[model samples]
Target chain A: MSSSANHAVSYPRFLVRLLSVATDGGLQFYAWMTFLTAIALVGANAWAHQVADGMVLTHMTDHVSWGLYIANFTFGVGLAAGGVMMVIPAYLYDDHAMHDVVIFGEILAIAAIVVCIGFVGVDIGRPDRIWHMIPGVGRFNWPMSMLTWDVLVLNGYLVLNLHIVGYLLYHRFTGRKPNKRWYMPFVMASIVWAISIHTVTAFLYAGLGGRPFWNSALLAPRFLASAFVSGPAFIVLLLLAMRWLSDLKIGAGPIRTLVSILRVTTVVNLFMLASEVFVEFYTGGSHTAAAQYLFFGLEGHNDLVPWMWTSIVFNVVAAGIFLTRKGIEDNRFLVAACVLTFMGVWIEKGMGLIIPGFIPSTLHEIVEYAPSLVEWKVTAGIWALGGLVLTVGVKCGVAVLSGHERLVKG
Target chain B: MSDSADGVSRRTLLKAAGATLGAAAFAQALAPLASWAEGMSSEDFLATHYKELDAEGLKTALKRIEEDTKKKTGVDVHVTADAPIPGVKFGYALNLSICIGCRKCAEACHEENNHDRKTNNSYIRVFEMDKGSIDFAKGTVDYAHPVPQPDKFYMPVQCQQCDNAPCVSVCPVEATWKEADGIVVVDYDWCIGCRYCEAACPYHARRFNWQAPEVPAKEINPDQGYLSNRLRPQGVMEKCHFCLHRTRKGKLPACLEACPTGARVFGNLLDPDSEIRWVLANKRVFVLKEELGTKPSFFYFFDE
Candidate 1:
């Protein structure tokens, strides 16, 4: 408001403000960041060991070539897609209160993308040769390979969300009303792009006709349904945290809208799950070997049976909570339902989905997979790194939106 | 840039110290990757894809590979990148009735292709199946009985070199492809080792180099092919290429030559009189997973 004549310094000062906000946190924040840094370093060490030795360190084999890394990568994509839930409500449905907290969801998307990329980077046998997929510089078999499509949609969604969040935050920091034209086009694109990111990820598996467990027409819709559930589940938690930690005046309306979205999505996700389970069990063919190994014991090997059942139970319980009046009226029950849904989807969409696709493999040889210690360490480290990114991003947004940090008229 | 009256504040000094220590620790954690990258020359790292390489570039790559192999294993292997012969399409057929579950073909492939000795890796997997059924689920590859067990039939599987190959289509980079002679080959250097091709193949034909191959200096196969049996780098995909190194040079495949019962046949499908063509004409042959529509060059038949 005071810098009408100094338009040139506005951008430079905005960058300074954005960069310096991380430094303004208190001792508690610094300790949290330090702890995350330590875990991230441990993960880096594990990854370096994996790189030096090769992918043999992972539990993956020629039979089960993808394991925990791909599982987490799939879940991370769903979480990233979850960001668009807020955008659809705030912009598409014209929910004015949701507009206030949409940036946090976008920030969460950015962090989830970082996690997805990290998992993929660690999963590949040749991380150094990743440049071979570059479009012009390398031979990228596009339009045919589902992996290439995943790479494109993931990176595109990341950029789309980044632009929307960046433009809005920069304007807020400069004390200017964001021109709708600047971010609205991107906001709309991100809604579609969000759906694409998860759809392409599902296609990456579903397109593999050899793995009959994943080769279903219902896979894409299930992915979208679960994404809507997990994304809103997470945003509610983020809003509750913001309410507790800061003075961001998040009203009850956004939470109510997100809960309503969850009400439909959680049931839809479970219904799809039921449909998938019914088809696999009732058919009882050679193609149902993976599903047999997943739901019940197959040839005395049932590694995923317990995990799959737990996920189903959690999803059903969470759905029960969301479908009830107490879920909306009681804060404690709401938090529990959110956590259960989040973890339930993590299991269902991750290990519950990816691992079974590899078990009883293409040749009908039942070679099972379980993540090793190094894999777990690397997975944890990536999550910590994501936590760091999300924390720093949200803190900066909170600082700017609260009018506590801005450009100084020197 | 926070400073107190007495030069620098204690808090600022502590923050700087913490930052430097954190940076040092992070570097230590990633030191292994730095050293691993240092072993690869810039030429190998930055080399263009094999198809994109000109004649001179191909020669340079072959020479560099030979030199690297010699330096690492003290073996002077001759690696060739022979082009496919014109008007020739390779086909392979195995007579299931005459085939014994001896695994000699798999052993020959392992030795000829310079596979990792520790894993005893081979492209050919011979499954011993029930007499009246072709169900692969009932077939066991780890059967330890004598050759041609009384009531069992042996069926060996390898890369089918499919006309509509799922592996070729699924590769994000064109690292693996179908060559002119109907042989599916992989350029190990160009493959990113995502193993998507391994998952896509219904035959389970593809194999990934999970670790650096450990063949002894003397045991290393002196004869190699850039697209076939050359010493593969760690962390890439490889599979049966019909022994293209020898086959392209008018020599028979190692597996075929090693077969004692003459159950294996390999020849140009375009040539009507070739043994493979005769097998296709005279025998009731079938390709696995015909429903998937992967038209395989490799076929299996029964004497009946």
Candidate 2:
């Protein structure tokens, strides 16, 4: 054992050291951070412009009131929920190799939630008045509004993950064995909370009976299934990157386990998509107007057709790759599958799902929406910020877990 | 000078330059927020929800709004927070048989509600549909040269003001609610403008203010109800309240008066002898999207 194990530092000292370790990094780290920060600044500048000018800068009319921002927000909720895929295998099944790197999953969840909240903040017309949703001071229409439930679940999931991750990391930093009582319950809660976050998000759209496109019973399950695919796909990419760049010896065990998870989830996602499409097309009605606009063209407005088809193609190809022998053995094929599935799910769950709901609007007006440049910048900025958070967190977390950084003195 | 002294001076110079650059960038980044802040007063930001405000507080809020309106549009608009009349349950009905799709009511609504002139925004959308069809897919709102076109029947849609309003339930903030008078209203100051209500309305009744409404000073309607047709802030939801400012005070709605064919009917639903009740009892009356079970106070009838 290392000599640092004998040093039992106070909680305050542990935090101070954690901050110091997180901030101090190599030249490559600085370069990556600088790139992310620059992009984030660009996004912020774009958002400022959006706010100063009206929402008119966005291509969203009163017809398609929601567009790219809501799309990103939906995808983000799934990504955040996807993070718990690691936690379940690690804690529930007690897979030793998976447990060793579960912190990365939790860290990803944190970053995702930050991205989710950022998208929501920018999406609202008055970010300044967000405080109105506060429970006591501002009226919160809870138990009624699905949005209120969503707010509760997303924040609750964030807190649960934060506690579990914080408690474990702090203990590991101080060279102490983490008590089960401190974090075990929260980990369990987070697993359920993860499911709730995405379900509630799906329900936010689903509950609107007026929008026949989203008022589906299958929406929540589809969200979870797709979430499992994207979540593990993301973690697999992270594991491969870490193995390549760092001296940390992540065995092939975690990657294999994640790939297997992705195998089931990816196919299930495609199956659900097919089922939805079959139901929409075979039983065509006025309600199928939005779906028709999405898949085919309704009234010659086929803006989303290419996007939807591309998403399906990417998802199918990736699913095919995952079922192959080289998907497990060859690192390049593994990376390719992960990238394809990640992007596939992003499109399928993001713009493909959200934009179509509003195309043939409630009154059957065929207004279309495309993201404005300002929206794209803001989205890029939020993602870059997520990237920065993940990088710094993984760096600090790996340093601690690998025994490179520990408490030197009490 | 010593090498250490020279290093200190160079370091200080770089630090000063960095600070200057940061300050300038920060100011530039916040320029939008600064300009946005200029439009909203601190009082407006800290204003209470309409229901939470006491009578005294409401008086102050009305005064503040009047002053804000004067400052923005140079119009001395009279804004009232008219409470619903006792034992009154407002109901609206349209005579579809005689309706010509003249769009005069829509125009009246646009002018009376002080809507943004650029979008020609209004609470009413008159759909010109085939005489035998109610399929919204076949309906068109963009007809250019139209007034009771041949074989086309006009159906005007507005907020149903449902007993179980989807819009009210879906609001994360109780910025909107069903009042005692059965008129669903929105506290314009309290809405965060997330547009959830817009998505929830089946009739496509709710309108979102994309930017500050622009009405020329002389054209601005001086008579306004606080929740009815008063100017709404940019980035909030607004919809028809059955012209409560006029309807509650024993005056007819601007739209009703503007309908040259007497195709519109309005009165208290609770009143046994009211015109709306008479239409409901005698005419073949139905509510739009009845399958949704919104139980709208608004009705449609045909005198076949």
Candidate 3:
């Protein structure tokens, strides 16, 4: 066990100190919080209407069972899994430059998981009866139902990460060295867990043999490849923003490593997408109607055509920029490249990935989906909630590390 | 982070108290909004699962639902939870040769199942396909012209009620399940409305109530079944239960009775001499998306 955890420390006092970190921030921090709070309130209000009005407010028709809510849930899971990239380098290889930022990745995971769970909360039609999924108390059908497995893994992952991040931060605050025994096994377990979270999410789609678009062997790998690209891109962008905001010394080493990971993953992600596209078009069978709807168009309805093409274009542009020497050397282009890759992967991994699976429904009817204003509001609300969580987590972590905050020796 | 002699500091105590008060205030503020929720009631929220409900619970459930229906829709519905008969495995078949695509069966289903009047949601979809082709994509549901167009043939699609039911396997809460008599049913009250079952169904058999379905009081089919065709909650999933309420009692399904051309066939598949068995034995019967291995009880055959 870590000496910090082994010590005679007061957890109640430690928690109180952590609470104080959230309340303490600058003018800019307050403004950011205000902006997020405003969005969250609007979303909360919209959610109220949705709950009162039923899912009718959303554009999900009889044919398309899922919509933007599920797509965002899928994307959030990917974002959460991306944090492990930082974990692998800092813990496995013991990269010194990565040490300061690894906790930030864990913080990001917490934020993303919060958003993921929130999206799920909003997506369901009956929020009150969610307890039916609770094991022991309800008929959970764990081994039989893939959704039950998903519930178990997601909650397990959240608690596991929270424990690791909390243990490390508390130790740092108390001015004690973290014992490897307390955290190393967890860090290693986390690496595997990170892979499982995304893989399990991919399996959620793939196991459904009914939907031809998602029933592919390539889905899990594609999910991982895209997750690596988007996850690191988000961290790099956040690190850059933090550097501009304060005297946080995030060196070029981690940034270079992130870009390197992005470049390779981007290429691999695009290749997998292309390979899937080739197979879908080459077959030209009835099952390929969903792929046809995504790439070209089905009948005269071409809603998703523009979005899919735009995502493909952005992927190419971002990949090209990342490959070039000047792109890496210039901060502006690097930032632009990261932003582009982030959006590209978001589109590819999100709406671009989920919505098409339902189009040209099982009965071969074209029922398109577009998120209504209420859905967008709730979506924005969840994101804002996530941003607020991340901001608070980062503030506490930064303060403890910088020695601006400390535990009382008494 | 320093602890006082008592344990926690004054500031920490105040902060905790303030947070609790803040939470209580938030809940109080949302109470009026909670009152605004129509159709959903405390009783509905506390309704137990179908599998766990005893005879007394089922009796109370039926009585409560009747009262709830009268209160919400101003329609008195007699909802019964009927058990399946032993030695009965229900099966359905449609004769593509005679189906005229008039969509009367679809209409009958909407009324019988208390489906939304506004959306005209039905358990059945009639696809008008080219006479020479069975490609469902090429089939148009909105041909608009008089159906039985000389160039086209009609196929009405609904839940296959698969023996190896994917919909049953995917329901996170076990809200949907296959009955002992081979018909699949959904306990509307227990569903979380995740819609994963809808996605798993290859036939697009399941329907989700995106809104509180409106049915005129006079048009409402007062006779209903708890698991088969009672008015579903706004956020749950519903589908054809082979009209098990009627079928288990030796009555014909709404769709089979509504068929003007006598195309729909249904029977106890376990009975060796049944008409459905005859169709399976003599006709070149086939099921849609057979590669999915759902083992659908519903079959389609051509007599032409």
Candidate 4:
């Protein structure tokens, strides 16, 4: 379309049109992509070092076997699950304003799930051995291992979401009406599947009875509450960024609706945290040792004290901001609240939740952990990869929806 | 699919799908070689599940372990993959009255099992407690004294080898399992090193290999079992198997032999006349965390 000679030779013009959008990045887009790609390469290099030198290079030890890698993995799962918040309201209620933005949620989910899988890949010691975890090809002890269930559900959700998104977009690009029968059921299933992914991940921790810090029945509920809070908050930030940068027509209606949802979820998340805290402190059981390490210093290992407190403060302040009508109306205040909420949940759910479960390990040994530089680099890289994927996906999505790209009828 | 110069074609989508699937399948076909280059041999990469191994496959695995040990440690190790003896479920009972907190059993297990020297990992942990309490928080494993204090009692905890093991049930890959003789054994090579079993074990009996174990060439225990005392690879889980190599061949476990007080008893529970059965009959014996219903073969009692 831009050049006459190349346009004349096009056979697969729908794909060509999608490819053109990615290729037609202005200076700003190219710079953003280049920066993301460069950082992603650094992450790849660090991963190479980890693969060569073994996990000893990581901040994790036998005492704290799952570290930042698993932390990010858990967070990534919640992030992916958050997409359903948008889906539930938009499709179920037939809120056309929100429906216009639902595709963004799906795209965000696709990005989050990809990052989740990447984190798992970097976390495992032997990347090549992953094939063994696949069903039928190797021994997958389903109904036995919670991790096996996690693998199944995460992948199943990925495929399910992929189908839903691909079906809608493919129809939109081709100018054909989507068959509601085929895609609507999947959209509904994805809502449940999204919640299930986070619940199962929580169970992955909770099922381990030995780690009393994680053995609580409240964990799954807490995961859902926090996931709903942080997930929507992140979507707000992304939607804001998209609106500012591009002509995405995401009006204030969806943002306010998302904020209201965030408000309720954040309140529940904080309440659950309070519930967990009161039980740990008041009961004075052996299970309190890990919780003790997280809040107060346990036997002089108080490294996480500052981080935990900061997360608590951020969460409390942000929740208050979102609860107020004025804060919801003011874009600046809303942005601050969302950022704080995102950071608060990231720390709370990741290190605050995961690390405490392992500290003062059931054997009562206190070996504190700090993620190594290499671990941070790897994490940053995965984030950059997510950014790149989302950018490319949204570019194509915007193009097809704007009618700049189309499939000619036969 | 028709050629359209002005719009997209179905042919392009099909070609891309074909190319992506072709590349993925081609890469997967060569993954065994890639895995072989990354420390696993082709044989180990292609090795079937432990339960799926037949007599011939087991024989080949045993020989490979022997060769692998020799190559890695320069120690000509005898690696045996033993099967359970039917109708002979093993049981152990510790006489708490006469036991001292020397921790020699812990040391023997460390050497016998080829644990990493840096981590100082041992399957057995001896806790010294005040006479009146069974509370583990009040117990100390790192006592600097030479012998048990006069008023103190010793309790050595290891894998309970539960009849219904939570660790076995939690393993996503079936890398660990309980044999008929009540020994919970881990297939070290097959384990994904997820440490879910370590987290699942109530007794904290499991140890994860953060690095490939380094046993000094001269000190390496040449007697090894494929699922028990063999030198383990990095990122896998290892634990006590009651010294299955020696016990399956009618010898006492290294920990039991190392106990200077002779407070440890090992026997087949199926034999009503065995010493463990007698301990169960005569003494007030109890298994650790029995409320969890793990049904441990290991028991503790006092002679008082």
* Per-model TM values vs. the true structure: 0.97, 0.96, 0.95, 0.91
Candidate 1, residues A157-230, lDDT tens digits: the string is: 88888888888888877777899999999999999999999999988888887789999999999999999999
- Candidate 2 at residue B161, lDDT? 91
The reply for model 3, stretches above 4 Å from the true place, is A1-9, A408-410, B1-33, B36-39
The CAPRI class of candidate 4 is acceptable
- Which ten-residue region of model 4 chain A has the weakest summed lDDT? A2-11
Ranking by lDDT: 1, 2, 3, 4
Record all residue pairs in model 4 with backbone atoms less than 3 Å apart, i.e. clashing.
Answer: A10-B5, A12-B8, A12-B9, A13-B7, A13-B8, A14-B8
CAPRI quality level assigned to candidate 1 from its DockQ score: high
Please list all clashing residue pairs in model 1, or write none if there are none: none
lDDT values of the candidates?
0.90, 0.88, 0.86, 0.84
Best by TM-score: 1
Give residue B63's error in model 1 in angstroms: 1.2
Enumerate clash totals for all models, in the order shown: 0, 0, 0, 6
**CAPRI verdict on model 3?**
medium
TM-score for candidate 4: 0.91
DockQ of each: 0.80, 0.65, 0.60, 0.32
Candidate 1 DockQ, CA atoms: 0.80
User: Candidate 4 residues B1-304, lDDT tens each?
Assistant: 2448543445456446645764564455334334436666778666677788899989888898889888877889888887888888899899899889888899999998888887788988888988998877778787897777888999999888999898998888888998888899888777877777776787878877766778799988988888888888776788889998999999999999999999999999999999889999999999997877789999999988
Residues B9-62, candidate 3: write the lDDT tens digits: 665575577567645744653443484455567777788999899999999999
